[model samples]
Target: MPHSGPSASGDVTGAGKLDRDVLKVAAVVVLGSIMAILDTTVVNVALQELTVRFQTSFATIQWVSTGYMLALAAVIPVTGWASDRFGTKRLYLVALSVFLLGSVLAGLSWNIETLIGFRVLQGLGGGMLMPAGMTLLTRAAGPQRVGQVMALLGVPMLLGPIGGPILGGWLVDTVSWRWIFFINVPIGLVALVATTVFLPQDEPERADRFDFPGMLMLSPGLALLLYGVANVPGAGGVSRPEVWLPAGLGAVLVAGFVLRATRIPNPLIDLGLFRDRTFSVAVLAMAFFSVSFFGVMLLFPSYFLLVRGESALSAGLLMAPQGIGAMLTMPVAGKLADRIGPGRVILPGIVAIAAGLALFAGVGAGTAYWQLLAALFVVGLGVGAAMMPIMVAALRTLRHREVARASTATNIIQQMSGAIGSAVMSIILAGVLAAKFGVPTSQGQLAAGAALADPATHDAAAAAAADSFGTAFTWGLVFMVVSAVPAALLLRKAPLRDELVPDVVDVPVGKTVV
Candidate 1:
C-alpha cells in the first residue's frame, strides 16, 4: 500500500506537533520493542533446565533456539506488507496480542515440541515489533528527533540481550524457567493497552498485491540456512550430507529470490535500495558486525559454563559487566553519531570491538575473574557504539515509507549473519574437540559427557575449544576492521537532511510535471 502525505488522516501523531500525547505513544512503542528484544536471549540461561524438563538430547533441545530464530527470519520480511495492508496501529496491536498469546502458550507447553512451536508463534509476532515500533516512532517524531528517539529506543534493545541471561538465570534458580516466558505477559498487556489508546490508525490509500512467490522462496531459504548452521555442532561439516544439503538448497533458493525480486513490481524487498552507496556499505558493515559480535556473545556463555565450571547463575553474573559497559556507552555513542555522523562513531567502535575480541582470544580456563570481566567490558563497549550507528546510518537517507522495509532488511541480515557465525564457530569448536579427544557418539553425546567428567579432560577440551574460538575471534576482528574501512570511506561526512524528502520530478524544456 502506498502512503499519502505525512498529515494524512489516521497518522499516529497528529500533524506537526510534538505534544505529551506523542511522547506517551512513543513510550508505548518502546515497551513493545523491549518485549521483542528481551525474548531474543531470555532462553539462554534456561537451556539446561529445559534440557532436563524435555528429557531430550542436547542436539534436540538446541532446536528450541533454532526454531524460534528460523521463525523470526520467516516473519520479518512480511512485516512491512502486513503493516501497510492492515493499518499500522491495528497490526501493531494484533502482533502484540499474538506475541502475548504465544508467551502464555509457551509457559503452559506440555512437551519440548509444543514449547518450540509456541516459541515460533512468539517469534512471528516479535519479528515485526521492532520494525513496527520504529515505523510508528519515526513517523510520529518527524525526523528532527530521529537521533534522540533512536537513542532512547535503543536503551531497551541493548538492555534486553544483556539482561536476558541474568533475568533467566535468576528466574530458573528462584522459581522456574516458565517464569521467563510468563514475565512477558504483563509487559505485553501494558504495551497493548497503551498502543490501542495512543497510536493513530493510519491506513494506506492503495494496497499493493502481496508477493507470495517471493516470500515462499526467501522465507524457507533463510530458515533452512539457519537450521543447517544450528545443526552443525552435532552434524559435523560439509562432509556430513545432512549438514551440506539443506544449506546448499537454501543458498540456491536465496539466489532465486534475488533474481525474482529484481523483476517483480513491489517486490518483498526493493533491491534497488542497495544502489545507494552509503546504504550498501552500512548494511554490509552491520552484517559483518553481527557475525563477529553475536558469534562471541553466543559462545562466551557456554565457554564460561563448560570450561570454567561456573554455575549458570555465576555465568550470567560474569556476563553482567559486558552489559554494564554497553549500557554505559550506548547513549553517549548514539549522541556522538548524531553530532559527528555514524561514520565517525562506527569507525572507532569497530576498532574497540576488534581490540576486545583480541583480549577474548587470550582467555583460558585459568583466566582470572577480573580479567574475564575486563575483556567483556571492552567487547561490550565496541558493541554499544557500533550497532546504533549502523542502524542510523542506513536510515539516514530513507523516507518514512522506506523505514519499515529498511529496518526489516537490516534485522534479517543481522539474524542470518549471527546464525552463520554461530554455525561456523560451532563447527570450528566441534572439529577441534574431536581432533583433541575423539569423535563423540553419532549424536555428539560422548564429547559432551567427556567434557563433564574429569578436570584434566575438561581443561584439555576447553583449551581446544578456546583455541578454535580464538581463531574465529581473530577472523571476527578482521571482519570488524574491514567493515570499518568501507564505512569510514563511504558514509556522508555530515548528517544528511533529517526530514523525509519527497521524490521530485525533473522538468525538462516544454514539459509540464506533476
Candidate 2:
C-alpha cells in the first residue's frame, strides 16, 4: 500500500468527501467494531436464562457478563503498545479472528464455567477493536475529517448497547441461548474478508521499548480489582475476605503502576496525556458518564425482565425507545461538535439524561408503561447527543503521533469504569432486594419469572422489584449529574482541526504507510 508523498494524502478535506481508500478502511473497522461492542450487552438479558440452563446460582451466572467485561478492561492497556509494534491493520485482523474463534468455543460450551471462560477469551480480542480502529481512522481521515469519521466509528458504540440485547433476546427466545455466540460467525467472517481485501496495510514503526513492567502490573491489577467488585454481590460485604483481599492488593499494585508511569519515558497507558486540559476534562467526564451510563443501562433490561417479569425478547423490545431516541441525534451531534465545541453540546445532553433518570428514580410497580417509555426516549436523545461529543472533545485536540496512545488510554478508562459501574449497581440492587425488601434476587428471580407468567403473584413481586430498582437508579442518577462538571469545561467553539495534520502523499493502490 504505497501512498505518494506529493498528494499529501493526509489532507482529504479538499475533496469534501472520504477517499475510496479511507472509505474502505472505515467500512472494515465499523464491521469489526459492531461485533466487539454488541457482545458487551448481548448477554445481559440472557443472564437469567443461563442461570436456569446451567442449574447455577444467579451470582455465578452473572459472571458471564462480568468476566467478559473484566477481561476487556484488563487487555485494553496493551493494545496501544501492540499497534505501534505490529501495525493496527494486522492486529485488527487478528483480533477479529480471535474473537470469532472464542465465539465458536463459547457456543459449544456445555457448562457455565466453560462459557464464562470462553467469554473471557472473546473479550481478549474484543477489547482491542476500538482503540486500534481509532488509531487507524484518526490517521486515515486526518484532523480535518476526524470528527466526522470518529462519529461514524461511533455507530457501533451507540447502537451496540441498544441492539445487542434485542438480537440476543430474539436468539435466546426463538432459537437457543447458544445461538447468541454462533451468530457472530457470519458477521465475523464477512468482517475478516472485507478487512483483508480493502483495508490498506501498515508497517511497524520504530516504537519505544515495550512497557513490560507496566503491562505486568496494570493488566493483572485491573483483573483482580474487577474480580473483587464483581463478587461483592455474592460476598455480601466489602469486609469479607473474598472481597477485600484481592481488591486491596490490586489497588496497591495499580498505585505502583501509576508511580512507575511518571518515571518511564513510555508508559503503557501514557499518563502524560493528562497534561492537556481538554483531554483530561474529557476523560473525567467519560469516567463519570461510563459508570452511570453503563450501570443504568445494565439495570434497565433487568428492570424489564426481573421487575416487570417480561420475557427476554419482551425485555429487549421494551428498551427500543432509548435506541430510537439516540438514532435521531447522534449524527447531528457529531456534525455540530465539529463546528462548535463539544462542551455546549454536552451540557444539554446531560440535562436531558438527568430528566429521564429522574423519572425512573421514582419508579414503582404501578408506574405507567407509556411514561416509562417516554423517559427512555429522552434518555436515548441525551446519550446520542452526549457520548460521541465527549469523545470528540478528547480526540479532536491530539497530535497525530498521540492518537494511538490516547485512544488506548481512553478505552481502558471507559472499560474499567464501566465494569465497576455494573458491579456496583449489582451490589446496590441486590442489597435492596434482600434487605430493604425481603426478597433475595437468586430466589426472587425464579419467583418473579413465575409471577409474570401467571399474573397472580405478579402484583406483590413486581412492586417489590420495582421499589428495589428505583432505589438503585437514584444512585445512578447522582453519578450522571456529576459528569456535568467536567462537560462544562469543554470549549464552546471547535478547535483548528486542519492545522495539526502531518504531510503525506497519495501512493498507488498497493503502496503502504509505515
Candidate 3:
C-alpha cells in the first residue's frame, strides 16, 4: 500500500476522537456510499411490483435481484488489484459513473428480461463501491479509529433501509418505478462532486502482478454457483441436469480456486489473511450472519406485499422498524468493539436477531402489526450491532497494505452470501407454497398474486400465504442460529494501535483528478 505502518499515538490514544481531515474523508465516502446502499433496499421494495408489471413468473423476476448480486460477486475479485492499480478515489468515481449510466438504462427498460440485463450493468458499478469506500475509510482512519468510523458510515448503510423503503414506496406508489432508478442521477452527481472536492489524492499504490488465474477461476465459479442455486426450485433438485451440471462444476472450480489461493503469493483474495484469528472469526461470523440477515430482508417485503395484500408503499412503510432498530444500536456496537474485542458486541447482536426471527417464524395472518414491527425493531438492533463491526474486526487486525484486499474479500463474502440467502429463501418460500397449494412455484405465485388482487378470494388466500412465509422465516432462523457459533468463537482483547508507515503521507485534497 502507499501508506502502511504503526504510530505510537495509535496505541496510546487508540480511542481518541476523530480529527477534521478524517471526518472529511468519512463524509466523502458516506456521500458516495449511500447510493449503492439505498439501491438494494429500494429495489427489494419494488420486486413485488416488478413481477406484475413485467408479467413474468416469480422465479424469473428474481433475476432482477439475483443477477445484480452475482454481478457484484463476479467483479469484486478484481477490486483490490484495481484499487492498487487505479487508486480508490479514481475507481470510486468511475464506478459511480457506471452506476448512473446503468440506472438510466434500467429506468427505460421495457420488460423483465431487459430490466434483469440492465441490473447486471448496475451491479458492475455497485460491486465496487463498498469495497473501495472501505479501503478509503480504513486507510484514512487507521486502526485505532476504525470502529468509530465504521460505525459512522454504517449509519447510511443501515439507515438507508428505512429511508430507502419510504422513498421507494412513495416513488413507486405515486410516481413510476422508473423514478427509483432515475433518482440516483442527482444524488450521484452530488457524490461525484463531493468525492472530487473532499477525498484526498494518492499515487497508484505500488502495483502487484494481476492474479489472472485467480480471476478466471473465482469469477466463473461464483457465477455458476449462484446461477445453480437460483434455479434449484425450478430444476426440482440439484440432481437434475440443469442444476447438477452447473452446480457440481461450480463447486469443483471454487474448491480449486481456494486450494490454489493458498499456494499463490498474492492470490485474488489473499487467503493468508485468515492467519489473524480476529479477521478469520469475524469473517466467518459475518458470512453466516449475512446468509441469514440478507435472506430475511428479501423475504420480509414479499410477506407484507403478498400475504397482507398491501401496496408497495405500505410494504416499505411496514419494514421501517428494522431500520429504526439498526439506527439505535450500530454506533454503540462500534465503540464497544474498539474498546473490547468484537466478540462481545457481535454475540449479543446475533442473539437479538435470532430472537426477532423466531417471532417472525411463528407469525400468522392475524398477528398484530405492532408485534411484527417490534420484532423488526429488534432485528434492526442486532444488524446495527453485528454487520459493520464484523468487518471492523476483520480489518482492524490487518496491516494497512492488506486492508484493500481484506475489504474486497469481505465484500465478496457478503454479496455471495446475500445472493445465496435470497435464492435459498425464495426457493424455500416457493417450495412451501407449492407443497401447501399443490402447484408449481411460479404458477403458485402467479395464482396467489391474482387471488390476492380480488377482495372475494383475498381473506381465504391470506392464511396459507402467511404460513408459507413463516416456514421460510423458520429456515432463515436456523441460519441465524448457525451464525452465532462463529461470533462465539471470536476472541476478545483491547484495541491495538495500527501505525501509519512513514512514507504514507496524507496528500492534500486540493490536488484534484477527473
Candidate 4:
C-alpha cells in the first residue's frame, strides 16, 4: 500500500516528492545508526583512561574494543537470515534493546573483564543495526529515493570518527569515562521509541531452514579475518604467526563458505546479488576506496601526535575539517547523483581523494594547520561525495526482496575492506619506520616520537617520521586512484524503475511473483 502522505512535485523524477513515511523511517534508522557508529569510534579515545582506572595492561584493556569488533563480525552474516525469519520492525527493536542493555551493563562494570564482556554484548546488537536498518530504510524509500535517503543516513557515519574522540576525551577529562557508554542510553531510548511509534510493522517472510554449515564457515572466517587484520599494527606486521595464522584459516573457511553457498538451494547469504553489473562494480569500488579512507583515518592522528607532538585533543580538533568538508558536500552529491548519475559524481570524487592524499604526502612536519586542514577537507569531500552515491547505485539496481542480502553483503565488504586497509597502512608504516630508524619494529614508534620532542635530535627525527608517513600516505593515494578503475564501470545514469525489475522465481503452476 502507498503511504498516506499526498505526493507532490519535486526535482527528482521517480521520487518527485518525499514520502512522509520514508522520512519518519529514515529518522529512526539514522538515530540508531548514529549511536552504533559513534560508539565504535568513541571508545578508542577512552582506552588509555580505562587502562589507568582499571590498573591493567594495554593488552587486557584492548579487549574492550577487540571483543566488540569480533562479536560484530560474527553476528553480521546472520542478520540477513534473522531479518527474514523474524521481521524488520521486530528485529530492529530487539537489536536496539540489546545495545541499550549492554551499554547500561558496560557503564556499571567494576572490572576490565566485565567491561569487555559487556562490549561484546553491545557489538552483538550493533552488528545487526547497520544492515538490518539499511534493509528497512532502502525498502521504504525504494530505489528512486534511495540516493536522497542514503545521504541523510550518511551524516552520522561521516561525523562519528571526528566527533568520537572529541566527545570521548571531554567526557574522560571532565566527567567519568563511564559517561562515554552511558551517553548512548538517551539516544538509544529515543530511537527505540521513535521506531515503535513511526515505523510500520513488517510481516515475517517464509523462513528457510537455517544453514548451519554455512554459518560455521562464514562467521568464524570473518571474525578470525578481522581479528588478524586488526592486530597488524600492534603485532608489528603480518610476519608474526599470530597475525597470519588466523588470517589464513579465515580465508580458507570463507572460501569454503563461498563454494558451498553457490551450490546450496538456500544459502545464508545470496551470492547471486553480484550478477548485477552496477551492484558488483559499486561494491568493488567501495571496497578499494575503504582501504584508502580507513588507512588515512588511522594515519592522520598518529601524524599529528607522534610527528608534530600535538595533544590528543589538538589532533582531534585538526581532524574536524575533513568532517566539515564531507558535511558540506554529501547532500549536494546525493541530489546530483539522483539527477544525473552516480558515475559522474563518483569519478570526480575519487580524483579529489587522490589529490588530497597527494597533498598530504608533500607536507613536512612543520606544515601549517591551514594547509593540512585544506588537504583533509578535500579528502573528506571526496569521501562524502563517493560513498553514499556508490551505495545508492548498488541498491538502485536491486529489487525490494533483494535489499536485505544486498545490505548485508555491502556492509560486510565495507567492514572487511576497512580493516584490511588499516592493517596494510600500519604494516607499511612499520616497515618504513624499521628501515629509517634501524631499530626493532616495536620500539621504532617510541624512538621516532622521542626524537621529535628532543631538540637535539629534532631534525633527524622529523625527517625520518616525515619520510615514513609520506610513504604511507602515498600508498593510500595510490589506492584511492586505483578505485576509480571500477568507478568508471558504474552505470552512466540512475537506473530507472523499469530497468530494476525483480528476477522471476520458479513457483507452482499459475502462481504469480510475490
- Per-model lDDT: 0.70, 0.77, 0.78, 0.75
User: How do the candidates rank by TM-score, highest first?
Assistant: 3, 2, 1, 4
TM-scores of the models, in the given order?
Answer: 0.82, 0.85, 0.85, 0.77
TM-score of candidate 4 relative to the true fold: 0.77
User: Model 4 residue 380 lDDT?
Assistant: 83
The residue-by-residue lDDT of candidate 3 on 1-514, one tens digit each, is 6542332335433347777767777887787678888888888888888877886555666678777887887777666667778788898888888888889999999988789889889988987877678777766776566667767767787679899988888899899999999999998888889889878776777566877887777767876776677677777777888787787788888999999999988887788889977788888888888889888898898888888878889999999999988888876887788778778888899899999999989988888999999999999999999887787777776676666577667877888788778777877887777666667766667777777678897777788888888998998999999988878877555354464132333311111000
Per-residue lDDT, model 3, residue 514, is 6
Summing lDDT over every window of 10 consecutive residues in candidate 1, give the lowest-scoring window.
Answer: 505-514
In the range 216-251, model 1's lDDT, one tens digit per residue, is 888678766765655565664566877788888888
lDDT of 4 by residue, 38-105 (tens): 88777766654565577643334545765676567666766756776778789999999999999999
* Alpha-carbon runs more than 4 Å astray in model 1: 1-20, 23-27, 48-63, 108-115, 136-152, 193-205, 229-241, 395-408, 441-450, 453-475, 491-514
Candidate 2, superposed: residue stretches over 4 Å from native: 1-27, 55-62, 133-162, 197-202, 395-404, 436-444, 447-456, 491-514
Per-candidate Cα RMSD to the true structure, in Å, reads 6.0, 4.5, 5.1, 6.2
